[model samples]
Target: MHVVMTSAGIGRIEDGAVAVLDAPYPDPNTVIETTGSLDALGGAKVVRRIPLDGDELDLRAPLGRPRALWGVGLNYHSKAERTGRPAPDEPVLYLAGSSSVSAPGAAVRLPAEETVQMDYEAEIAVVIGRTLDRAAESEAWSAVAAITAANDMTARDVMKRTGTPALAKSFPGFTPLGASLLARDAIADPDAIGVRSWVGDERRQDSSSADMIFAIPELLARISRYAALRPGDVVLTGTPAGTGQDRDDFLRPGDTVRIEVDGVLPLTTHVRA
Candidate 1:
């Protein structure tokens, strides 16, 4: 089942029909309150049923504001090769502010600086379901609630100058999360999924979660050792090779970045440079 956040409430879409769940805003609360528990996401209380075929619904970000937005860098060998950086033994984690998230369709508004060299990083974002602290790799997967597509938009100039990832990528609307979230139960295999992206017609990234240097289970377990992960906390799996930086082809006005996680809706972000 797909979980969507609309102005009305949380929407559960399945089998061509949508059941509007009677819940509150921000997925962290909605998942637990209406369902009484995050683990049983399917048990949410439905307020109304609407056929998705001809319905027009105003959707919002599945996670209104993630409590913690953790990003992994150089997790893919291809990305490491492209950047001429060695793949790290452990997941390279950086924290971006929760306010960076925007609706899937929202435009990436660029800063007015003339040196702006905006780039796109397509990532498979994992949203934690239950709280996990010092969890083991074997049990880390169980704490996952859902998966979503994300564009980890970055300002290359800022990163190149200050060498601080959080500052470069934490701009408002930099993180375009999702149009819909795919529950973990709906995926046949959470560990293996296709992740790709495009800059208008040019396909830039083509990779799989299976190609990650540090897989999901290890990433979660590794992160939990230092900090606790709660519901709605997001982990941005590293983007693959073929970013604009590889060719010095930064984003400009009218450029659209489209990213996809196999099975979920494609995330599109227009550029306003």
Candidate 2:
């Protein structure tokens, strides 16, 4: 099932059809609090069937307000090789707050004061389905509910200056997430999903999750040990090589970024003036 949250209401794609649920936006925390678990909402009753049109309604990020938006850096072998950095023994973790989250077709506001070198990182985002603490690699995938694609927008100059890239990456609307969330069974093998990105007409990043230095289970196991994972906590499985930085091409005002995960979702964001 392709779960979707929109201004119209909560909806899901069932049997190649879209059905709107008779409820407001399903916030992960609120759902868990009321229903005992996120899984309980999977069978929500369909109230209305609406005609499908991409431009008809406003699509919002599937997770209403993610508790923690975690991201990993240098997890791709090709990305590690390009920056002349060795694959870290563990995942290079970073945090992007909820404020950074944005919906598809939204505008990413450039940092006016410190807008030096902005870049786009196409990544696979995991949506946690349940609470997990110190979960083992064998049980990591069980904790995931859905998957989506994201663009981890960054201000390279701000990162270089503050020595913490999170400052650059967590700016308002920096994280553009897909509006649709594919169920865990949507993909037979999540580890090998395709990730691609484009800056207008130029394809900047094209790679596969198979190239990740640290796989999904490993990342979940490591991150869970340090931070208790809850439903709706997003984990960005690192971007592949060919980032704007590596290509010596950075985003400026009036630029558009489109990122896609072959079997999951695709999202686009525009840099505003």
Candidate 3:
């Protein structure tokens, strides 16, 4: 079932109608409530009448306020090779401020003072469902609720000049995530999906999750050792090799960036000054 948490309400996609769950799950005040406990509420009662139109509502991040936004870098073998960096034994993690979260179709503002090497990276994002510490690889799957497409927009020039990539990556509106979060059960194999990115009509990056050096399970296990992952926190798996920075081309104003992942939703955003 495709689950979408929007400002309107939580919607579940069914065969014919969309089930709209109440505002807060497992609560009585919720106009449309689901059955079972928080953990066991698996599509028992669905609130019908809600529309599936992706528009008409302001879609916030999958979660209202995530504790932290964790991003894995150079996890893709090809991307690592392009950057002249060897594949690491573990995931290379970076922190993006929670305020940087923006929804699909939003405009990504180019930092005027920074260099003009703004680039786009398409990635698969994992949404954590429960709080966990030292989670084992075998048990990590249970902690994830869904996966979505995310564009890790970056300022390459600023990163190179400042000597800190995180500085450029953490800018507000830098991460434009796709709408419509696909439930974990909806995907049969998370590691085998295809991912692609486009600048307007031209394709930029094309790759698969199978090429990831450290897969999702292993990434979760390793990251959990350092810090506790709270519910609604997101871990963005790294992008593929074909980012604009790899090709030495940057985004210009009025450019449209689109990302599509098989079985997941498509995310599109425009570049603006």
RMSD of candidate 2 to the truth, in angstroms, is 2.1
Which scores higher on TM-score, 1 or 2?
2
Question: Each candidate's lDDT (Cα)?
Answer: 0.82, 0.81, 0.75
> Using TM-score as the measure, what is the rank order of every candidate, best first?
2, 1, 3
Ranking by lDDT: 1, 2, 3
Give per-model TM-scores.
Answer: 0.91, 0.92, 0.86
Q: Give the distance in Å from residue 181's predicted Cα in candidate 3 to where it truly belongs.
A: 1.1
Best by lDDT: 1
**Clash count of each predicted structure:** 0, 0, 1
Q: Write the per-residue lDDT of candidate 2 for residues 134-246, one digit (tens) a residue.
A: 99989888778778889999888888889896898988899988857777766788687899999998898999889999898889989989899887788999998898789
lDDT score, candidate 2: 0.81
Of candidate 2, the 10-residue stretch with the lowest lDDT total is 28-37
lDDT of 3 by residue, 1-273 (tens): 565555556665565345666445522112111221123335445654555564454554544445678998789999999989999987878788878778767887888787688899999988777666998988887777767888988888887888675787877788887566676777788789788999999999999889999888888888999998766777888999999988988899999999987765578888988
Candidate 1 lDDT, 1-273, residue by residue in tens: 677776676788877766787654456336642342344546768888777655566667878877799998889888888888988987888999889999867887887572478889999998887788999999988878788899998888898898999988999899999877887777788668899999999899999988899998899999999999887788998899988887789888899999999877788899886
* Weakest 10 consecutive residues of candidate 3 by summed lDDT: 28-37
